[model samples]
Target chain A: MEFSYEVKDSYAEVKADGRLNMVSAPKLREFVTDVIAGGSSRIVVNLENTAFMDSSGLGALIGCLKAARQAGGDLRIAAVQPQVKMVLELTSMDRVLNAYASADEAFGND
Target chain B: MTEVLAERSFRGLAEAEAIESVHDELDGLWNDAPFVEAMDQMTFTTAVIESASNIVQHALPAEAQRPVELGVDISVRSTLLQARVSAFYAKPPLGQLEPGTPDEDSESGRGLALIEALVTTVTFERQDGTNIWILSKSPQA
Candidate 1:
């Protein structure tokens, strides 16, 4: 998986493209941590290209969410594909992660 | 005897890379059996990868001389998808096999529960120093 970020006016948009599996989960955590350290706590992880995710990946997202909140901001996901959506719902994390239809809509009202 | 419409097998060192390889095998299997519903393919793939990832992350070597090897055998039949995910040269699992209801903020402990929800049945067996998890899901009509 590859992670890249763009600093929008209110938050950072982190684009993660590829399978979010055990192999790539830790990297995602580290990448998002770096983004937070770079002065953006409000985050939007674009999962449009992330086709698959396992438990480890879910854990990583939860960890990222907590990190964002600790910095007094928030982390939300947008453009979740089918497989990732299934994992989130099955694990009851869809309620926690809070998916939006698109990146622009993630922090639109906030 | 059950006729297998398609099958795929993989054996390798139980580690991070094997997960990707197994996932690739699963993608190819789907290509071979395109008649399986998208939902079935998606759920079964996730369940198999979860079981394999569990072995890579947690399975312990049974002896000093040999490291654990992950072995996966997946087959698609007329109306079913089955996978035998194994950890060779591994000791008996250390913790409970049952799923836990972790706190929402918890980062782990959800794999087993997710697997159970995705598949029709899940069973475990340990024999000859190999621990195997059998997962079967019936494709939707």
Candidate 2:
């Protein structure tokens, strides 16, 4: 998977393109942590192009979320594809990770 | 027994890259069996990948010189999708093969449960130093 980030007005939008499986999960966590340390604790992971995610990938996201919260901000996922959504709901993480329709809407209220 | 209309197989060292190969095989299998329902395809694919990933992440070699090898054999029949994910040259899995109940914040321990939920049946067999998980799902017609 490829990761790129842009600091938006309220958060950093990280675009993760491709599969978010075990091979790429650690890289994603590292990338997102750097974004959090870059002074943008509010992070939005855009999964519009992320077609597949296994439990390892889901764990990476949860770890990233905790990192964001530790920095006194938050992290959310947007544009979740079907496979990712199924994993989220089946694991009951949809309640905790909080998925939005778009990056613009992730931290829109905050 | 129902005939298999489509199938895919991969055998390689149980490493990170093997996961991608198994995934690619699943993608190709779906194209070959487009008649399978979308939900069935999604769930079965997830279960298969999860099983394959588990082997790569956790399976330990039975001997110093013999490294574990991941093997996946997936087949699609008229109404069933099945996969046999194996960890060859590996030690028997430690402890009971049961799912864990992790709190929301936990990062790991959910793979087992997620695999169970996605597939209709999950069975494990240890034969000749290989740990195999057989997953089967009845495709929605």
Best by lDDT: 1
Instruction: In angstroms, give how far residue B28 of model 1 lies from its true place.
Output: 0.4
lDDT score, candidate 1, position B33: 96
Scored by TM against the true chain B, the candidates give: 0.98, 0.98
True contacts kept of 1: 0.92
Q: DockQ for each candidate?
A: 0.94, 0.95
DockQ of 2: 0.95
Report the lDDT tens digits of candidate 2 across residue range A1-110. Answer: 99999998889999999999999999999999889888999999999999999999999999999999999999999999998999999999999999999999999888
lDDT of each residue in B91-130, candidate 2, tens digit only: 9998558999999999999989999999989999999989
Poorest stretch of ten by lDDT in candidate 2 chain A: A29-38
Taking all chains together, each candidate's TM-score versus the true structure is: 0.99, 0.98
Could you tell me the lDDT of residue B11 within candidate 1?
Answer: 100
lDDT string for model 1 (A1-110, tens) is 99999999998999999999999999999999999999999999999999999999999999999999999999999999999999988988999999999999999999
**Candidate 2 Cα errors over 4 Å, as ranges:** none
Calculate each model's fnat, 2 decimals: 0.92, 0.97
lDDT of 1: 0.97
Write one digit per residue (lDDT tens) for candidate 1, span B1-141: 479999999999999999999999999999999999999999999999999999999999989889999999999998779999999999999999999999999999999999999999999999888999999998899
Interface RMSD over true interface Cα atoms for each candidate: 0.5, 0.5
